[model samples]
Target: METPPKTDIAAALNRVLLTRKERLRSKNHWAGLAKIPTTTVLDAFKGSNSTIDTLTKLAEGAGMTLAELLAHGDPDWEVQVKIRNTFRSWTIEDVDGLIRLLERRSGPRDSDAS
Candidate 1:
């Protein structure tokens, strides 16, 4: 199959940074969290494209995958990405327990909610 269309990396990085500004705060903070160089973060803020490895670290620092970072324009998708990131290191049983607890708090799921 043909590869999916490439996102505009610079634009995507800008969007990610904007969406995460409250947490990331400054280029130095972002670089520290992503374990990348401050200059790289500055370049990204200026709309420069970054290497995949750099992008991956940046995405991780933002609590998301690279794909989620690139496709992060939607508000709902943003929530889902955050939830998925939060759950990434949990055991299946732990996740199931959380789901059950959430279900109890929220009441039964709607038939069409899924």
Candidate 2:
């Protein structure tokens, strides 16, 4: 299948920030999260060219990978990316526990009913 065109980088970054509005109340908050200067964050939001390192820091601040941040248009993919990023630091037992909890909350699957 043909790949969908990506959104502008600045717009994608803005969308991610909107999703994190509760925590990132302002640009300064975002910069703090990214551990970058406020001016750098401002430049990024304005579509100014930034170094890969800066972009990586920004992505990390947003709880996603650099790739995910760059490809941040799809809501479903965004959620999956966040989940995947979270899973990276989890133990297998933690993952299994989460699976069990989710399954319980979601009830039995069709296969289980059979």
**Highest TM-score, which number?**
2
Give me the runs in candidate 1 sitting further than 4 Å from their true place: 1-5, 73-114
Model 1 scores a C-alpha lDDT of 0.77
In the predicted model 2, the residue pairs found to clash are: none
TM-score of 2: 0.59
Q: Pick by lDDT: which candidate is best?
A: 2
TM-score list, all predictions? 0.55, 0.59
Q: List, residue by residue over 3-80, the lDDT tens digit for candidate 1.
A: 765666666666777878998776688889999988987887676767888888888987777878877644455675
| lDDT for each residue of candidate 2 in 2-104, tens digit (9 for 90 to 100) | 9876556787788778877887778898899999999999999998887899989988987777877776655465776677668788999998999999999
Clashes of 2: 0
- What do the candidate models score in CA lDDT, each in turn? 0.77, 0.82
The TM-score of candidate 1 is 0.55
